[model samples]
Target chain A: MKRIAGKKLVFFLLFSLLAAFPQIVFAFPDEGRFVFDEAGLLTEAEKEQLEYMAQELGAERETEFLILTANDTEELDLSEYIGKFYDAQYGTVATNPAGTNAAILALDMENREVEVAVFYKAEEYLNAARRGYIIEQITPYLSEGDFYGAFSIYLQSVYEFMGTEPGESPETDPLLPDPVMIGQEEPSESIFFQWWFHVIVSLIVAGVAVALMAHHSGGRVTVHSATYLNQSTSRILNRSDNFIRKTVTKRKKPQNNSGGGGFGGGSIIGSGGGITKGGHSFSSTRGKF
Target chain B: MVIHYKCQNCGDDMVFDSNTGMLSCHSCGRRDRIEDLPEEFITARFTEDEAKEYHCQNCGAVLITEKSTAATTCSFCGAGVVLADRLSGDLAPKKVIPFTISKDEAVKAFQKWCRNGLLTPKGFMTGDRIKSITGMYVPFWLYDLNSRVQARAVCTKVRTYERGDYIYTETHYYDVFRDINLDYVKVPVDASKKMNDELMDKLEPFPYDRLKEFKTPYLAGFLAEKYDYTDDELTERAKGKIANYIESYLSSTFAGYHSVSYQQKSIHTNKTNSQYVLLPVWMLNYDYQGKQYLFAMNGQTGKIVGKPPLSSKKIAAWFAGIASGTFFILTVISQLAGGGF
Candidate 1:
């Protein structure tokens, strides 16, 4: 009877172990090469800084994150080139297939574009706010042709940003250090997070349907094409446009810490991204340095 | 009288082929030029004051297509005949834009419209589905309205500038007035009660220069209708069209203002004229899934318009496709474009 109780307890413990942490199901992704500074633009000191940051982040996150800098892309579309380079350098594993847990930031000095490619969960985790915040910080340096300084700051920010949770929730885990951000952009004040975005999508789709429903059943609205009317016979009596009241809307402009801000708290503004090959997707906040 | 041209080479029937816009013999493929149409047509009233039957002189076969059909081919003998009594007097068309689009072309247009985006049911464009094709001469009354428009508007201009940490917007308001006199020429409304007003409106701006004098040859081998609505009745609809046109015209003059609101407006007509006429249309009727689909194309300009039957199945599929796409994409865009939350 005692042995039976012992076996039941063991089974129960094993089941709980699987259930408690279902998401940590697989082994950590293999750490591939993390830096491809082919541009040779980075000095020895700058290269060392990137190498250390890349190695540390790779060890901590188990994501094959890379920081590549090249003088000019060889006639390849910058975004496409970044995707191909990411696939070749790390040759993503099937386990972390879309690099969902991985990311790569490629900076091109000659053509002047910054690309951050994220795979799999990294897209959902890194989020747009973080991407925009990071880009705002590094733009000023790149515009001034400071490649080493730009990359040096970039490496540090990525290390710090990866620690921050997705969605930038107010509650932070006590164990992990909060992110240190540069160019601290202000978060949105409105609780209407994606309202406009939702409205535009709804409008386009509904417009097509509403338009189809409106006249599809057969009716006609006389258009404003009165130019067909005889213009010479009609004379103007009186016409004028009078001024009316003006409305003032105040948008909470983000606090621009372009001077020097680290990733503590800031919302990314005007960041855009899209999907790449092999079904791998990426999100980025970028500025020209 | 309806006058149909015949093929001299063969005893078979001939028709005014719309594809070639000429009188072509259907049996022998011979084409003939119609030179006597203008002189043969007379605007005098019919002495009989009743509809008349026409018999082919060549084969002694009675020619009948539709009650309003002025000209037709003998089904038995394949000879063309024109009903002299039907188009004798007031029944004669004052002007005509002959059928420029052929039957095959109109059928092809219907097929293309049906298959666009798979909006209709499967096999809706099957050739066997077309029930009938009729070349119709639809009657209309053209109105020329000359009017002076008076309008008063309150307009606004807004300017914005940033100061320190705040943005300021200044709006200036003014009262404006405008008086414009305009002449509208040839706004037409269908005068035939048989024609659907909505479908007729889609066929517009027929080149008036092509309108020849009252002619008999133009009505050959086609269905036609005489105007049923008098000038007094059609004037009302034409006036409404003119008023709407004038209102929009007056409203358009107030450009460059931030905003404009109407105060008062008046349109005074100086002159109005109405003329009875006929326009050509190619019509195809299709009955699909127990519902009728009517397709009409302008005979002059080939501007085609029709209401396609909505496929419930296709609509459901489209909604599913668009909804899923919008849902996934909008979510991703909102996160990437807006705040993290």
Candidate 2:
């Protein structure tokens, strides 16, 4: 009878853990190094350049920097896949005078998704507005099959966007090999402001509709009341409005990049750096390149 | 300095007839060609101080006019008199768009405009109580400007993605610029303070190609006024309008930005060329309930635009009609849903 009772108790405890596991989140410290190219898209020299730049930027800004590219996610449930492995292998403190907040940029080649994970604490440097700008800088190159150029631009822009003094390398740990961390079902990612993004999109769409309606109102509405405009001939003298800058943004693309890769019903989330899958909400802007 | 045309065949006064668009003699029934008039109309010149009044030789009636009044009819004999001085010197208009449509046609056009759409009052101007219809050569200042516009804006583009347990937002910034060169010609601003700015604006798109050189015969049948406002006063209006046009031209060029806001705007006018001219307008005024309702027609294009007073009764009827229609539809729909169909 006692043996049977023990078996029942074990089953009950296991059941309880399974039920509560999805809701539980774990916070981990930051790692000294940031740039990781798991997809092997970057060369040894290029990888070293990105890592060096990220490390210098991280040390100066006191905010963690990560640039990771991975192949297809292992057959793990997408919601459970996160920066958990990276989180557990990194820093000791959440916020120090020096800095340690999680900000990860993950490029998934198989799925054609470029995920940027920003932690709550590091949101100041990687705010909503700044993130949108960075995507614009990276997408054109991404669509044009220039992954290296795109990644390089992204890394440099991020470094500058954080308001860091370039070439001013603060005291950081020496270079180390990439850590091998097989992630478990641990949560360490957070997201905020999905509704706010939607609201902004709605307002923009409505404004565009109203502007179109106004444009078609009348011919008289567009020009001033000088009768000569109808009779005047316009000449373009030395006409040039060349592109000063070329940037592209992504906003929930049906397909990723100009490659026209068909998207499926699968998702893989990143976790870590004081964030988890359950209560730590996350928001991202995506679109076709 | 007032000039009048006389019938060469009958030796009677020849007046401009609106229906025939020619000088017609009422006594001898002689029709003369206006283009056949001599070239003295071009060489002739007069100043505001050179002419004050004149007497009709045939009718023996005195005609009085202001310095700017170039054309009028004798109140006693009803003879068309042209103040040649008003059409000359500094007061002379370099260009003139004569009244092509007659008074009868103008009144008919006004009535047709009142019947434009459902929003207009049903019987607003159909009662033939059009108190007065005046053909006026509204003084205008035409401007020719060559401008350069440069705009600077802070634009943002946002991209987003999701990985594992987190969604990421990626933002980028751009320093956007637009350099535009705009050459505006024949932008007209009314130089007569007596004309309603709004009314004149609605009478836009005057046919400028038909503009004829200043001629004395053109004024014989029409009432004309010299400019009261100087170029300096109207320049402010013209510049304001140019600035608005260039700004709109710049903003329309940008596309595909999540958010774009202008940080700096600069407009430079290389040179402004101006001319004192006159535009033709058929001005119609009606008095309803002691309130004057004015209607202006573009004498060139005949496109009419104006704001007419709304009738409260009409509005109430519209609301009632819509409400009842909606209520009936809902009632039928609900009954069908309840299996009463």
Candidate 3:
């Protein structure tokens, strides 16, 4: 009974705990930003550079670009440029040193053929100029476009600008591996185990309930039936007529002796004929049966 | 003639209470049990044949009297019965729903509703300006119907390809078919002519299963009016609702089809049943600047719906307060982060 009660109490507590503490599954954290531009214009070389950058950074390719143009133009049509790039065999192009009239194209590497932006400004276009330089310096030797050269150069410059070593990676960052993230993973494992654990606990609880009910009935039957049998035997013994007759005969002589002396004087004739008179009262006949 | 016990104070007819199990006088607040009387009286359902039309002796207003009817005062003049209506007919309803919420609870609910109103006029919540509120059982028709719909539409799928150094477009066509079965579409139609149909429609859908049978005893603490609209009139409104559902369902079911042109659609309905149900609503009518505003409360759900007065000054002040708080918090955070505050 105690074990059963304990099991039931445990079951209720488990249910309450489950209801109170809901398990939350954390989603994968977002990796990095996808840079985007308003206008779409990309040469084949620019697209390759973006794909390589995405791979190096461990980020997904995003269909967005930043457009840098020479003029402050809100609207520019780049359909002809896009069509030409599609037909061209060479991936990269280098313009003459008069880079003021140059257009720096960025492609949406994820979608393959969508031109994201065209950057044309020269004076204030350090990133575009660097990218254009990297493409021009490597594409001719590589036969198509040198993605590794552009990616490595960009990463090296960003590391230098941030005052960090170029060899640093996220895997070795001490502060980035936060303790809270580690703590959260254990609870996720426990949640996965909870389904089977609860089933086993429920079976234990059911077994306990059955054991408790059986124990209660066992005590009741033994105690009640013993008392009932004792009462019935006592009633039958007292009702026997032979035991009553014996007990009555044992008391009869004593009762008669106590009454004898009071009437002895008047019954003096009782020795012979058992005739007795009290205060001269008339005595009549004798009868024998 | 049966002797009728009537109230001496207000002279209104006393009603029998089954909860307290006594005949209660509404006017003078007197109560007595019928079991205390010498003879047992069985209150019969008032029929048109057994009803007597009594002309009001005091005000000449016609009144109906039955076995349970007890009248001491006239309805119009508020005077004791001098005469009774001679041609009065049976006006008592077959069933009624008793008031579930008390007057105090209703007022508290109303006040809570007022506090929640984002835009309410100044002094609107003051005790002096708070108008007398009334609990009314409004009549409505609940309809259940089985609807079947058939629709046909022309659908298109787009395909693009290159032909001789130029992109060309190709379109494909296919016929669309939709068959649907709908059941127990509950549509509520307001029975009162004074109530706005549009407002009632917006406050849709009280759960009809919770409705209790009508008992006149429930009317003791409330003001109620019988429905004036018939079933036939409400059926017309139900048809309009069904038509609207058909149009929307057809459009959404085939939403994937590009450039869908509907050819033909038909909706058929059968096994329609309607019941006249009364629902409890707490009404607050206020007149502000010559315009009246109506507020309603769902008695069962306790959800209040209404339009409250807006104050431009309050709104501006609130917006400014939020902006100041936001700026202060951001400034503190930035300073802590070694950024220019």
Candidate 4:
């Protein structure tokens, strides 16, 4: 009886270990990672820095941020792929996990496209318009093949927006206005549109025109020096040129170090919000590279 | 001292005709070539005191004249008179350019020129408001000048190239010297004190090919003036005119240099010859807005020189239009270039 009990215990231990393997892989904090670069678009150093930033911000905001890249989605659409990934990690709508907030940024290399997927409480902050604005800001960096820049902007924008209330401008403090709003309003009152600018310019033009007209009213002198010159008798007698000294100067040339080569001919996709097959509601903006 | 030409066919006084270039009769349409006339008729010989008052030959009226007036007409009789005493001896002119443009042609040309003034005041172009237009013979001195120029300048030549990671600039300095001789002929200087020098200078380049030997008949009908300043007194002015030409010519010889700065330069000029001559001009007096404006036209070439009053309202409108156009263009350009980048 003792020998039979030992064998059964060993079998039980093996079965439990086998069952726990997937749980470890799918767990969020267990992996302690936010970026998965399947496309190999970012350098190792860039990936490290982004990981550090996402970990710090995610902890502070009490949310999970995930950035994913793929060589291609094959026949599946980018949104469908994102939904499947989200379901595999957090379960489907029928078995949806409670008290979880996750914002996912996914890029598909083959289509040169990017999309965002939000889960749980994140949906309340990043609405369609706000998500579109974030994507618009990062599209230029993505199209330039600056994946590192795009990821950093994504993390920062998400953090700032989540801290503010819904239906509000994305400002760090809700009481103060957005800095970008001030910038846009300043130009309308610029000197180019002012009354004094037009008046001063017109006065200058009028003064010059009148002066020129008055000057030319008196006719020009038609007779030049050659008009009365005795050309035959005029001659050059002597000429000499002696070189005195020589000097030389040298200067170092300037160098240019631009970021990276761009993925040319990139374009934007349609933007909208919809519930995934897993019943996770999200607002997504599409950008191309 | 006043002499008048009498028409052989009719006893009426004859006047010099600009169109026919001959002595013409008004009552009878008879014209005589002064060149074919007797020497006595062409040259008037008279002895009179310079200070004495002169009377018109046709009318016994005392001619109101200035001291420098050589030829004028009788205001009462409207007869053409020539003062022979003032035109002879030391006050004589060597050459004369007779009036090729008549009084009617000059008036018409003046009106056309006025219409071409873009900034002139309203209705000023009609030219019907001219008070008087006088055909006058103005005295001038034509000078021949020769200049000797010697110059020394420091010049440089620069070359730039890229080698490896550095840009190299090489400059070579040169010491240049030049000797030149420049001669200008028939540079005219107006000797009349009454005429504006600036206006007269603008009406230059009279056709010297039409110059003829001076005869009293050329001044029979037109008013003439003797020289207020002699050629010897105006030599300095002629020299000043040719100084700019000499400097420009000196610089032309020192070409092919990046930059040139003159260290030392000398120019010595000498007057070779000067002759007294009479050139034709049409003077116009116009009255506008209680003000008198004077205009002068070259009788031989019909070149006009004068300033016309400008309209303030038109200038304001033009300024507004240009400013608006420029502003519109700049705004569109900035917007199209993504807010000027």
Candidate 5:
């Protein structure tokens, strides 16, 4: 008994330990990687830091810039080049120069407008920006040869930026509407009239229905059988049962002098006990024939 | 020799009444002189082996002879004064928690439970529909065990660095150890074959301090029975409960691990003692659409828990409303987008 009990205890403990394995295994968030755009929107301090860190970490840099003129819209081969740049930044193209860190800067010649987009690494950039520092801190240091110092400064800057109190950023408003009320106007006359009319019509219909029901019901005995009869009549009319009966009656005719005569007297007489009554039955049968 | 008392001119069997403290005789109106028995006769103790068993005359159910003396009525039939069967075993209960909450309280608790479940169907709470709420002292084996769990896992540390054009990944591994001491209390293993084990477990953690000596007087208004499962079976279940907790605690403590391979893992549990006690529960059975649904409420705490029947028509209507509303909203949005009003 003792040995058996020992085995049972061991089995139970093993079962419990196995059940809690999944919860313990996966608990950490994924690592962070950042992408930077051109036009120097990021602070110089951030760019220098990122550059030094990139060199120290042996990270590759890929950049592509394009200028487009709205006047020359016919021969615009910008899509092929943009697609290539996108492939280099996001696609699994090893030899492509614009790998991972590629930022596309599109210059519209006609409008004199510029649009910069960093591919694949926007989350990293946002994380850095959230720390109150920009890419400019790391980029310049990467241009210089002190890779170790640059990387250290970049990491410290990111940590410091992350440690600082977060303030409202422009990125928070992309899809969300402003909280403040923009404009106010009086209710439209048509919508108001529509609602009022519906309410008035519903009330009038209810009132008329109640009045008619009351007027018809006063001083009259309400036999439940009468309501059933009304329901049956409505059902018959809706189903066209009367029309079917009329058609069937018009097609059939009596053949003999007997009141119930059709195919034969013997056959009809057996089934037509009520129709073949005494006295005026023969006269009515003759009239029918 | 026949013991009889004469009432003036007539003779009849006469027994002493403890409450009235007088010997009364029928047939002829007369009171006989009462004789008091020694204190030893009034107070006697019977061990598990010595206790006698009595069979219920009405249902043929057997009960211990000791229990029969206190409970004049049969536990099975609620019928009066049945002779007890012969006691044969050495496993008689040493203590029992008498019913504190009465039958009326149980019924009220059941009705309150019904009222609280607002979405429950109508006609369920009607007084006539309640067949019977029999109070039964269900048999339970409480096991206490001290557990020691040893576990190991491979911890991971991820280091990411870019090498020229590509990011290189490196991960380090480590072994984790955990030594835990657990004192498991009152792991109840239900003895009834008919009762659901899962449901019983869910209705657990009853305070054991309220337990009192087994007295048949407590069985007067409530229903109760001894456990069918032996101490061995219950001990096994208690060990299982302890193991579950230990594993959960270990897994939580060893977070950020890639893979956990437990080696030399063992749990040692020692049974300190065991007790048989009675806990109160209000049970309700509802029949809907030719099917029975069972609900139970903890009598002492008044915590109600049960599954209710779902209406197919209401579910269909809800689904139809959702689909229609979604389509209407989407259509309106698309029309506005297309500038078609």
Candidate 6:
């Protein structure tokens, strides 16, 4: 009975050790886990909450939503660091026949750099333009020190982007609030409402009014030629209108250079998605918070 | 030389009454047809001395008069006296337009005109500072003029239209020529040096149809002036008065052209005849802010012309009100168009 017990204990110990091995060895990103706040930017509770939400959303949409932060990466470039991190965790489509679909939001706290990188099937949905829109939306939040809110929005955006068709925009998501359109100038107030415009117009009107009053201070001449002219004897003795020449002038019509509206297709980074020297393919938009 | 029309009924001094168009006695209310008066009475007594000082017929007071004054009242007796010597022979007027507006009516019209001055000073608007009002017959030269106008010009009619991709402008050029003959009669030029030419010109259309042959009785009750300048001396001014009329008449013949550039234009105006005439005017002298303002009214047609003192404060307030109102309207319009806030 003692020897049987010993064997069972050993089997149980080995089972426990095997289960804990992945956590000990691979500390960056765990499968089925989304939030990785290496820079200590988020509270433990925030991470846990975001992780659960991302996990559920990722499963439903069939795309991995990631949030990553690092205090410093030494000499490693931000895009390079995220690319390497992605490559180590999940290989690209060429290497892994089954492929990985993921959208990664990585922040470098020390460098003040933020990037949205897409991998595998995510590249089809979150093209550089859509990624650019997500960045623009989250930047204000990040700048305002709303890390948790920014991350939550980023996860929601990625999930919504994946649910739509490859060529479609996530802006059409019914659950999302209306966004300020990207690359469009903000609508300005009308000139008629401007202070200077009113001043100038008023000055002109007042000047003309005053001038007319001053001119008519002396009465106008009431007599016209017809007042004294005798119509019976006065007549047009000779009148002639002879045609001389005709002239025609033409000007070419101006051309219209405005393109159609909506999201621009194809790749947006460097004319196409960038490829690392290590062969990790991604479409990304990067900026300072 | 100074003669008074004595009433045949009451022996009181008679004056020409514009309302009755007859010689009237103010004391007895007697009216007499001027035509029924004897020829000797109408011609009056003419003296050849051309005296600078004369005695009033009723008062025998030396009448104070200017060199150009043909008729005036006696300062001592308040009698209406006419200097018959000035109205005789070469100094006589051929026609006269009698004063239809009485003194009371003239003063009332002046007050009403003052009330209508929007920018005039507050004190000036009441018209209570009137110093004097005088009925005077100013001398003028009535001209019968003929204008012969010959003009040549290059004119064009321009039209613009649009096609699929281009804008086209078509211009049709024309050579226009006009020869016009125009006649203007009784264009009066003020011949008195004391009257302002511009002020006299403004009080026009003097009811020339009411003109009557001049008689000494017409000048009995009012101050009158013999022409300071002769008809020959004022002929150029009469021509100048009709120059604008001739030019406008020539332009009327070229009405259809869009633009005209005159190549050659000549206006030849000649005087067919002229006559010395007397036109009635009411002159009001007002004193305000130590400045004297002269206002003139046409006696026949009751037209008033003068410049009243303007109030700067009122003008400024008016400007501000108009500006703010216009601004508010413009803002509302832009808001309705979905532009301004």
What C-alpha lDDT, on a 0 to 100 scale, does residue B166 get in candidate 5? 54
Sorting all predicted structures by DockQ, with the top scorer first, yields 4, 6, 1, 2, 5, 3
Query: Residue A283 of model 5: what lDDT?
Result: 8
Query: Which residue segments of model 5 deviate by more than 4 Å?
Result: A1-289, B1-89, B125-128, B158-170, B255-264, B285-293, B305-308, B313-341
lDDT of 5 by residue, A1-289 (tens): 2432354356445434433342332222221123232223333443343433333332322222111112232343333333433553345444433344323323223332222233333223323232112223332443453333333443333333322333364234221112111111113223322434444544555455444433332112221211111222111111100111111111223344333222111111111101111111100000110
Where's the lowest-lDDT run of ten residues in candidate 2 chain B?
B332-341
lDDT of 4 by residue, A1-289 (tens): 2332354356345434533342332223433278889899877656665676688778888787889999978678898888777877777878964635888899999888888777677887776545665666678788888787778778877877678665443444342234334333445445654545756766677678767767888787887868888999987888899999999999987774322211111234556676777787766767655
- The residue ranges of model 3 lying beyond 4 angstroms of the native Cα positions read A1-289, B1-98, B125-128, B157-172, B269-271, B287-292, B315-341
Which RMSD does model 1 reach against the true structure?
17.7
2 versus 6: better lDDT goes to: 6
lDDT of 6 by residue, A1-289 (tens): 2432354356446434533342333122244368778899876656665676678779898888888899987678877888777776777546765657788898988977788888778887777656766776677778888887788778766776677654444454443223332222223534655656777787678768876775666455688888888889999999889999999999977775322222222112221356654476777777666
Superposed Cα RMSD, model 4: 15.2
Give residue A289's error in model 2 in angstroms.
42
Q: Which has the better TM-score: candidate 1, or candidate 5?
A: 1
Model 1, C-alpha of A85: deviation from truth (Å): 53
Q: What TM-score does candidate 4 get on C-alpha atoms?
A: 0.67
When 1 and 2 are scored with DockQ, the better candidate is 1
> Which of the predicted structures, 2 or 6, would earn the higher TM-score when compared with the native?
6
Which 10-residue span in candidate 4 chain B carries the lowest summed lDDT? B332-341
Candidates 4 and 5 compared by lDDT, better number: 4
Lowest summed-lDDT stretch of 10 residues in model 2 chain A? Answer: A176-185
